[model samples]
Target: MSQPEFDTYATSPRTLTVEDLQVSVGDHLVAVNGVSFQIRRGEAVGLVGESGSGKTLTCRAVLGLLPETGEVDAGTITLGEGATAVDLTGAARPTWDRVRGARIGAVFQDPGSYLNPSISVGRQLVEQLRVRGGLGRTEARERAVELFGEVGLHDPAGVFHHYPHQLSGGMLQRVLIAIAVACDPELLIADEATTALDAVIQAEILELIARLRRDHELSLLLVTHDLAVVAETCDRILVMYGGEIVESGPTEQVLTDPRHPYTRALLSVATIGDWSRRTLEVIPGQPPAAGAQMPGCRFAPRCRYAAQACLGGQVPLTEIGTGRSARCVRLDELVTDASPIPDRIEASA
Candidate 1:
């Protein structure tokens, strides 16, 4: 059966693009290696990978949230459409300050971390409006209350006086969403946005994000390891391994008929449509520690099909089909009925 049409991640004209993005911690370990992708206005893109696969790092690079030790060593990050574009990698700090939360907004894993405990949720939101938005205090306060209501919060007026500790996880997440969408950014980076919430809250948060994107025509880059979530939320999917994109394409094609071994292995571990068994499957071996230099494919250590030729120079992204590519040396070699990429998955756990 064909996968259901996912309009949430539907394609639109490109708004943001990253090319050859290489982020590193000092001169040592490179956290994000030659990462590149594009997010079109109103389209949702999912960046899926194991923890430390550089998904978070890649998102942070755009938000200017890289740690003190980290830096964008190479590549270009362009935001905006047509002639209005800004190069994020080369732009000044003041430029990023202007872009952040205005042209580009971010919703991260922990709302608590960004929320001010000492202040009322309404007050802090007003600050964002006044500072980034340059609204007067009264106008900002009114806007904040309206935003609370917009996010489906009950009693937006009362919630305005409530502090961070007063609201439930879901409510707090809504508040964060309110702040993120306050300025109507062109691109919203949701880095593990729902990861900290409970299963039910997770669903609510994702649905809220989906609704916001739809209603506001917001572009989104959802960062998460949950294939199930990505499958439900994203139109386009990018699979990452060892700080590099292994495979990327439409959600259906990549999930059902993965081209890269890593993509297939990731699907093997994620419980998708349920080929149930007594035991669960997992990708063997951890990713290489940060900064570890490799002569060939970084995933070769964990890749089941690793051969003598696996360890060479950097594997290039090979186009398997239109707008689809995989950074696997043996993409063609593995594309056969005998390869058992999907067959094994369908047959076993």
Candidate 2:
């Protein structure tokens, strides 16, 4: 059969659009609630928050890798835009097989665990290329080698035959990246992809991801707790707290002038900017546990500027500015308050 006129899904400008996603664990515990965001073609968006902030869960829901006990309770995860848009809320295995790797790719923190210890890494890559890329054995091997080289692995032919254990952590990660993009997936999800690496390696990997995104015009969804990482790599940022997006906007805008109190708190503690050493601050209270019952604003208990009204009822993620939203009822008052939102904790006397 002749090739179709065009691939609408691959050409769609909006690579991923998640709307009001709700993921529940067991029956009562909602791990991710009312979360929403979108990533345009070639856009790099960061999903950031402390651990248990539903960052990973939201990504998992999109990738269809949620645990058996966990289920997408509500909302829709739309992949692509217009005629090719697919609702991935409860997509079947075949749909996932078509999307994952081919349309969407992912890289997680641990690289070793994802690779088969007994098999040669190149063989694995070749297999994926044959299956996902629809290439013959010889073509798949050639493409796998090219991908390894594309990911900056030296001696691509030599590395191809080496087992996963033979490669260093960074090398293994590169192998994973090579496999992830072998099929030229439209979206790449990096869930703490560089967290386990040392400072130098981390920087290298981040630069690699950035370069790959630029070269391939791939939409990137980077998940991490490190604000500094996102600031360097992502175009836009979505700050999550208590299973919801507390703030979303351009990375520079969100980092510099955060509107949400939680975002502010995170900034106060984030190690960014100058190299000069300074006492690190910390947010006062622990984050709310997943599915924890909170009638009003989830961050009210920990917010320094919180008032009675904050805890009175449900506080919406109010759009406060152009492309900025904050889940704080006191945003108006806090903005006009003479005293700014002070640093959470200062140096001890």
Candidate 3:
């Protein structure tokens, strides 16, 4: 039988397209390498990797909210398409002011990091609604109450008046979520949105996000290090390593049938650790730091199947199948079993 065609996902109305995005810190560190991906309307794509893999920086680059000293060095960062497509690459502050909260909203990892402790949650939400949504104070407050209810906050009016510090982490996160969607942005970049909450609260937050996506038809770019979270929340997965996209595909295929050694190594930790009565499974070796001069596949140093060719030079991305891609030199011979991971690659944790 002929091999199944890999380019299976048909085109849709894309909300955001990030092409060849490069991010740097000052003039030294290249935090995000040439990363490219698109989030179509109503789709949820997860960016997963170890910390420092450039997931957060990529998200920051899209909204022009990079931290001090961080900047997008090259490539196109466009929102929408065709005549309406806004090229955000090095866009001015005025353009960012209009596009950020209005066109592309975000919910970051920590609510306190974004929320003002001095201001009431209701006031903040109202400000966003009024400024971004162009509503009157009364209308914005009313809508804030509605959003509070929409995010599953029981005491909408009461919660609105309370300050960020008064509420629990989960509650404050809900408030942030409400602000993120106040303008009904086409794309919501949720970077580690559930990281600060407890397990039960995390589940609740994830469920709320899922419900919002289904009801409001919101597209999401969720960035996290947790594989399980991505499996449950995302439709597609992009695996990042050493500041580059190493593999990408449908979540089900990528999680259950990964073609990259790095991906398989990640899955092995989850599956084998759960089943094993013996040693735990983990991928050893640290990812290359940002700005490191990598002459070959960055993952080659840790990969169990790396050959001499894998270390000689840059590895181009290989289309594996069914909208999947990986940057492995031995893509055809890779395995995704939950058997014992090699001792050399077992993480120490």
Predicted structure with the largest lDDT when compared to the true one: 2
Displacement of the residue 282 alpha carbon in candidate 2, Å: 1.5
lDDT of 2: 0.86
**What is the C-alpha lDDT profile of model 3 across 1-349, one tens digit per residue?**
1111223324767788999999998676998888998888778889999988999989989989899999888889999988879989999998999998998889988888799889999999999998889999898889999999999999798998899889998998899899999899888999999987898999999999988887877989999888878878888889999989999988877876788888877876764225444667678888887899977889988888777777778888888776788998776655456555454433222
Residue 170 alpha-carbon offset, candidate 2, angstroms: 0.5
The window of 10 residues in a row where model 3 has the poorest summed lDDT is 1-10
Q: Which residue pairs in model 3 clash with each other?
A: 6-322, 6-323
User: What is candidate 3's local distance difference test score?
Assistant: 0.85
lDDT tens digits, residue span 1-349, model 2 = 1111122223448999998899988766998999988888888888999999999989999999998888998999988888978878799999998999999999999999999999999999999999999999999999999989989999999999999989999999999999899899989999999999999989988888888887998989999999889888887889999899999877877777888888888987887885575887888888898889997888878888777777678788888766677787766655533356664422122
Give per-residue lDDT, candidate 2, residue 114. Answer: 98
Instruction: RMSD for all candidates, in order, please.
Output: 3.8, 6.3, 4.5
In angstroms, give how far residue 153 of model 2 lies from its true place.
Answer: 0.5
Better of 1 and 2 by TM-score: 2
Q: Report lDDT (Cα) of residue 215, candidate 1.
A: 88
lDDT of each: 0.85, 0.86, 0.85
Shift of residue 224 alpha carbon in model 3, Å: 0.6
lDDT tens digits, residues 205-291, model 1? Answer: 888888888888888899998888888888788999889998998887788788888887887788877747557788889998778
